[model samples]
Target: MIKILAVGDVIGRPGRQALQVGLAKVRESMTPDFIIVNGENSAGGFGITRKIFDDFINSCGVDCVTMGNHWMDKRDIYEFRDHPQIVLPANMSNVDDPAKGLRILESKSGVRVAVMNLLGKVFMKGENSCPFAMVDKMLDLTPSYVKVRLLDVHAEATSEKQGLGQYLAGRLSAVYGTHSHVPTADERILKNHTGFVTDLGMTGPYDSVIGIDPDSAVRRLRTGEKRNFEPAKNDLWFYGMLFEINEDSGACTGVHRLRFPAKDS
Candidate 1:
């Protein structure tokens, strides 16, 4: 069995620190063969920076980093988007976007693992293509040798996520949702062996509103004013999912949720 670790969105500094503190424990306990993290918000609750990306890979030992709608919020990303460890959404309508949406990586056990990022349009505002079609194209583009495939569906609507998960049931090893920042209770393996989860939740402060400072988030919602959003500092936690896949068949045999609170600073 190949153990795969999928971490949720990292909010900001606190989130990074939480990973710095908790990832080692997870690694020691679970010993995952591959580690993938949603790093769209790793910079400052907006987008990821090159320095932060390096920290995730070099310091936190992340093998792959996936992004979401906030993929372009930081300027440094343009310089590092070509990095093999990072990937943006595949369905982006902007043909000029240079970042790749799908990537195939080799795990520690020499298994080829295909990872793809996709965006949902149910309630999102963006010029993106159909996620269903994009996924199909990505699967076709992936080499036949790669059997362990994972998709990060960064979307707002649960229905869209569930639909995509069901659509790719027998083809993918796992289908996980992000962007919601709130973890869901439903996690199961479909009859076809695809592991599914609506949302993996955020790996940042849990005491605030989806990693944002509660006061600022409330002000923007209540007064309709644009306020500088900051990442929350309290109640730090690390949220993710652990998957056990059969290497030969590329079928998920176990799906486990991981929620670890950060040590008191």
Candidate 2:
């Protein structure tokens, strides 16, 4: 079986620290064959920087980093967009990267895996392509040798995320949600083949409003201020999902949700 861990969006510096601590604890209990994290908000809760990306790969030993609507918020991303560990939203309307939403990677145990990301149109601001159509094309183009396939649906609506999970139930090994910053309770196997989750939740300061400072988030929300937001500094948390897949059949055998407070990590 291939063990894969998918972490929720990393909010900011606190989230980064939570990640390192959480990884330390997970290593003490169980080691994952592969680990992927959504880091679109790692840089001051807006977008990830190249330096943060490098630390995630080199320091945290992450396998892949996924992004969402804010993928372009950090200009430094363009410098490392081609890096093997970075996975951008495939259906992004203005994106023209080489990965094309699908990346074939090798796990620590030498199992071939593929990571894909898609942007949703429901309640979103981009003129992105149809995620369903784009995913079908991506799967068709993906090499057959890569069996363990995983996708991160960076969406806002729970229904849209769940619908996509069902749409690719038997085709993909796992279909999980991201971008909402609130983790959902649903984590299960679909059609006895695919692992599904509504959302992986936020991996940062839970005390704040979705990782932003309480005062700043409310200041803009209540007063319609245009000032930049800052990340919260306390009450760190970690959120993620773990999936066990049949390496040869590319079927998910087990799916579990994982959450940890700063104290536990």
For each candidate, give its TM-score against the true structure.
0.97, 0.97
The candidate that achieves the highest lDDT relative to the unseen native structure: 2
Cα TM-score of candidate 1: 0.97
TM-score of 2: 0.97
In model 1, what lDDT does residue 224 have? 83
- Please provide, for model 2 over 1-265, each residue's C-alpha lDDT reduced to its tens digit, 9 standing for 90 to 100: 9999999999989999999988888878888999999999999899899899999999999999989999889898888877777888988997733266788889999999999999888999968888998898889878888889999999999999999999999999999999999999989999999999999998899999889988888999999995668888888988999999999999999998889896442
lDDT values, one for every candidate: 0.90, 0.91
> Residue 23 in model 1: shift from native, Å?
0.7
Give per-residue lDDT, candidate 1, residue 61: 85
Model 1 lDDT tens row, 1-265? 9999999999999999888777887977879999999999999999999989998889888999999999999998999888999989978765224237888999999999988999898988878889998888888788887889999999999999999999999899999999999999899998768999999999999989999999999998999876878998899999999999987888999999999897545
